[model samples]
Target: MNKQEIGTFLLRVMLGFTFLMHGLSKFQGGLGNISGWFQSIGIPGFMAYVVGTIELVGGIALIFGLGTRIISVLLIFIMAGAILYVKLPAGFMGNGEGTGFELDLVLMIIALHLGLNGSSFLSIDSKLPNRKRGQVSDKMAS
Candidate 1:
């Protein structure tokens, strides 16, 4: 692979692993606790389940380069929600209350990049016939 492809591959894998760990942690540490925390934050408790499932499934798809752009878009939305609802009030340094949106912002930007530029040729999406890079279809030229 070329230099750019290698970089994209690394980004895809790292981002995937990050989300996967976060999702897996909720289940490992206790989904009920996470759900309770969500409720405390004004988000519906049941959303914890939906978020966790999306993170887990999306992470796997990202790691394998199955649907990098689509997964990235979903993850981007999740990070945006996190920044808006959960991290904005905390400020840059957490201000002693909680962590801020810095990390979330970074994740959101990376997801955005992945969504726009897509994964490298090393991904499963690239292996498919007619599909190029992270594309799901080849109706038009890249």
Candidate 2:
């Protein structure tokens, strides 16, 4: 495909894979432990499971380019929440004492780009009949 298409595909794959791993790690480490951590941070403990499941499912959808815009938006919310609640106070460098929002912000930007652009290439959205070969597609709108 073209460079832009390849780039978008790569971004989708990377974001999906990263989140998939994170979700898997949370499961492997025990949901209770993750829930406890969330509770400690003032978030409801049950939200840990909900967020983990969403990340896992959303990551798969992203890799396959299914519901890309919606998935991107959901993932964006997760990243934004992370930045606002956990990382923003730590500053840019992360300094070992606490993590920083820099990574979360980068992920949020990528998610926002995908949300606005839709799944440009190598995606199920593009393969659907509603999307024309050369037209600008708002997959969700269609």
Candidate 3:
């Protein structure tokens, strides 16, 4: 296997898994509490469900490399929303009661990379029928 492809696959899978867990957590027991928190923060409570759904579906898409580019873009927006609407006020390092946007930033950067570079040859994106050779590839060239 191409090493660059391997690296890209690793990155995508890890990112996907992280989002999946986060989304799953939102539904596991805390969705209502999280929704209430969202409303308390001035956001509509329904947004919690929307965000949770996107994170859950997008996470799965990324994991399978099924919709890497689109999912990555969506994830970027989610991260931006998290940073601007929630984490920014917490301070860069974090507050006594809450964490900060640093993690969101990192996740966004990774999504950005995947958005720009696409999933590599190891991904389902590459193996899909009707895809042109080299149409989807990572730029790492590792």
Task: Evaluate model 2: give its TM-score.
Answer: 0.86
**Candidate 2 residue spans exceeding 4 A from truth:** 131-142
Q: Estimate, for each residue in 75-122, the C-alpha lDDT of model 3 and write its tens digit.
A: 999899899988998888799878988889999999998999888555
How well does candidate 1 match the true structure in TM-score terms?
A: 0.86
Question: What is candidate 3's local distance difference test score?
Answer: 0.87
**Candidate 1 overall lDDT versus native:** 0.87
Candidate 1: residue pairs that collide = none
The residue-by-residue lDDT of candidate 2 on 1-142, one tens digit each, is 7888789889998898888888888888999999999999999999899889878888888998988899899999999888877887788768688988888888889999899988658788778777556777676558
- Structural similarity to truth (TM-score) of each candidate: 0.86, 0.86, 0.84
How well does candidate 3 score on lDDT at residue 68? 93
- Give Cα-based local distance difference scores for all models: 0.87, 0.86, 0.87
Q: Where does candidate 1 stray beyond 4 Å?
A: 131-142
RMSD of 3: 7.0
Model 3: residues with Cα > 4 Å off, grouped in runs: 130-142
